[model samples]
Target: MNQIDTGLVKRLIGEQFPEWAHLEVKPVKFSGHDNRTFHLGDKMSVRLPSDAAYAPQVEKENKWLPILSKELSLPISTPIAKGNPSEAYPWPWSINKWIEGETVTKQNVRDLSKFAAHLGSFLVELQSIDASKGPIAGAHNFYRGGLISVYDEEARDAIENNKDVFDETVLKHLWDLALQSTWRRKPVWIHGDVAPGNLLVKDGKLCAVIDFGILGVGDPACDAAMSWTFFDKSSRKIFKEVLQIDEETWNRARGWVLWKALITYDANKISNKIVAEESYRVIQVIVNDYGR
Candidate 1:
């Protein structure tokens, strides 16, 4: 694990908010693979990239998060600067008004109906945001370690190299299904990673979503695909109804799940047992349905 210099984090925050100089600044650990997030009192926060590769997308969030906060009604982290002094921070960074909430858990899934309504309203509001004015141009071609072509022959070379961790037959099946089901519809702005962790719950209702670093314009199904991560069939039905996803979009959503599952399996080859198991589960569900 690369060590994050909390001194640098403190220095950056101190420079960004000089008035809060005496407020306690402590480093807090959060679950995420890409960006570094920290709490700032009860009403604000800051995030920095652990990987330099995401610098561009980090900048995009700095530019577009405010627009989404304004025109869209969903709870979002609104960017606030210390009175136009944003450039004071060393790398591209943004300060967000602290949204009070907690990460929805697996137990929360039992209340799928309530979660569905919250998630449904959020997606509907997100899809309503006009894509024409955002600073981001098109698909987030560079996010997710920039592996948009998840099934390219060359892409699977490492997995092929180590045949033990991956099943060649299952991999091939998922690849074929994904390629055949690629999107044919018009692209729109999407919150690319709508996983449960990004969702915020307060008072038994979803209050807001954070982590816009993966926001982009793409097949809206990329957002809907999260159903596999956070919802079951009944809850997903409510999700689909709210988003108005059609048959083709459903296929593309399935493709999104397959590609993301493969990526997760590949990246966590050595570290996470849970990710590997979940990847198999996603594949099983997809293959069973596709076989039907």
Candidate 2:
């Protein structure tokens, strides 16, 4: 919905695939905090990076998508065309195969029991995939970085950029609390960001999972945080049975939700007051339950 240039997109398409010169470019309203996405008809998608800082990750996404798609036994929008991605464009651009479906929300996730079953089945399928096949080089940081290291850099960057939206004292206190939260064993491959926006549903069933930008090997707790987003206690118990996660893993998952919630506010000023307030609600749960 923002001011997107249609002509530039057409030019890029022509440059990448001169054979598709006649195809019309249409804008899709879907986007995330990191990338601007457009649907190129029913079978292809085009993405332009939101910021130069994300170029490296965009590059990684381009490489990893096809690799993981083959391994996950699921549908994915693999890149077809790419731009040089220097100062001229400021950020990278990629065209991908369009994946169709609506994102899952609380409305779509109505039958909590069924939804939990679906999630459990999906996680089992995801975990069964051989990690050795899609070995993502340069992705070791994600598994090991954890909250303690991520917040250190985030705080340092906030200070350097003079983006003092959060008070330093408050940020340090919150970061300390998040670090002290119980973290489980090393990691298994995780979605990293498993919010409602990334999951797709159709006809009351989960059809596809998108947004692989944060896809990496990390704490399974990262994905388990989805329990708070949808599953209630009963549904979550069912989820554990279907996925075969033990109680110790479940506890770490609860810790992950709190830890991820706390570290986020230390860096950026959330634009939506409602979301900020809701995040604080989740933060309070983490503090009372896990913060020692």
Q: Which ten residues in a row have the lowest lDDT in candidate 1?
A: 139-148
lDDT of each: 0.65, 0.62
Deviation (Å) of 285 in candidate 1: 3.0
Q: How far is candidate 1 from the true structure (C-alpha RMSD, Å)?
A: 3.8
lDDT of 1 at 75: 76
Q: What TM-score goes with each of the models?
A: 0.82, 0.74
lDDT of model 1 at position 292: 56
Please, what are the lDDT tens digits per residue for candidate 2 over residues 1-292?
A: 2244666677766766677767777777657876677766677877886765555656767877776677664575577777764333566778887777788877776587887788777766665665554433233335421443454565445433433443445435545544554445443556666677777778777777777666665445557777655565678668778877765566556545644554454333456666656656665554443334
| Candidate number with greatest lDDT | 1
Give the best candidate by TM-score.
Answer: 1
Task: Report the lDDT of model 1 for residue 266.
Answer: 68
How far off is residue 100 in model 1, in Å?
0.8
lDDT of 2: 0.62
lDDT, candidate 2, at 2:
29
